[model samples]
Target: MTIGKGLLFSLLISLVVQGCHSVVFKQSFDKQKWNDKEDWDYPQRNNVVDDLVKNHRLKGLNYKQLINLLGIPQGQSEDSAGIYYQIVMDFGNDIDPVYTKNLLIGFNKDSIVNSITINEWKKP
Candidate 1:
């Protein structure tokens, strides 16, 4: 094979390999700013949660294990069946945002995660 053709083939292979990998953007959480509506600017929080769940196996994780992995949740509530931890994400414009995403992790009586629910809302 000619040097030029070989180089082109190598470049094409590299591009294809790179395209196969999923790109995940890392997001940093601030406890103090978590509740601040003006400061809540994480558009990629859903992606972060998705990646964490995929990598950490959150389904069977216990309450303590979840806390250890994800730190304290933004808010939490208890019910007859289990406790719910709320992870919220806000994205879009300041005047009229696109949508808000909420990830609810439910822990059963044994304190082991049993359900993962994602809810999204769009502006009216």
Candidate 2:
């Protein structure tokens, strides 16, 4: 191939690869912002969930302590024996959206936190 043609092809490939990549910016968890109102409406939880799980030692905290730090969880959606804090709920025209995300905190029998996880639910 000609020099010019090779350079153009390489540039096109580079641009295509870069454009295909998805960029995600993770934020630090802020108590004031998270518990400002309610979790179901707060969409920033997805960005800060990593920071909360990584930076903070949530495990071993009792129910009261967990509540004090994270506030009330989704009592109705308490499935699989874990407290769920909604991170993102895509509400479209319909009553229920196909996509959902949450931060799930699982506790042991003693009411002490044992696991903290990010749970995503996608339409089947």
* Best lDDT among the predictions, by candidate number: 2
Write candidate 2's Cα lDDT for 5-79 as tens digits.
Answer: 999999999998897664445888888767765634875676778899999999999989988888888653466
**What are the runs in model 2 whose C-alpha is more than 4 Å off?**
1-24, 38-40, 76-80
TM-score for each of the candidates: 0.52, 0.72
Cα error, candidate 1, residue 89 (Å): 4.1
What Cα-based lDDT does every candidate model obtain?
0.62, 0.80
lDDT of 1 by residue, 59-86 (tens): 8889888777665665664444434334
TM-score of 2: 0.72
lDDT of 1 at 115: 83
Worst 10 residues of 2 by lDDT: 35-44
Clashes of each: 0, 0
- Residue 20's lDDT in candidate 1: 67
Which pairs of residues collide in candidate 2? none
